[model samples]
Target: MRKPNAARDQLLHDLRNAYEGGASIRTLVASTGRSYGSIHSMLIESGTPLRGRGGPNHRRRVP
Candidate 1:
């Protein structure tokens, strides 16, 4: 059996909960002191079902 990674698992859990609680990746990065890419990758690895990108609909505006 492999050694358990409690800390990493907890981080993944916390990230997942925070994400499901509507916390943005940027916000999570700031709060967790983790890099944007690292946090984003973690969120994906943790299966957070990332929300769509933020900002106004440029396609709608250009139409």
Candidate 2:
């Protein structure tokens, strides 16, 4: 079993690298074995800037 603090540290480290490396939340979920909500929450808790819902001109796209 993983220790709680160690796991949290590792998660933070991975989150920084992955987020800076342009890995999407879905990708982080697949790699970190964490849920989408968990990852999103952690990102917020860590003060990591959240990306917008879509790409640059996504809002301009037709439904």
Per-prediction TM-score to the true structure, in the order listed: 0.80, 0.70
Q: Candidate 1 residues 2-59, lDDT tens each?
A: 4769999899999999999999989998999989999999889888898889786565
What does candidate 2's lDDT look like per residue over 1-63, in tens digits? 855697787778779678878999999999878899999988886778888876675555668
> Model 1 clash pairs?
none
Superposed Cα RMSD, model 1: 2.8
lDDT, candidate 2, at 6 = 75
Clashing pairs in 2: none
TM-score of 2: 0.70
Highest TM-score against the true fold, candidate: 1
Q: Rate the local accuracy (lDDT) of all candidates.
A: 0.89, 0.82
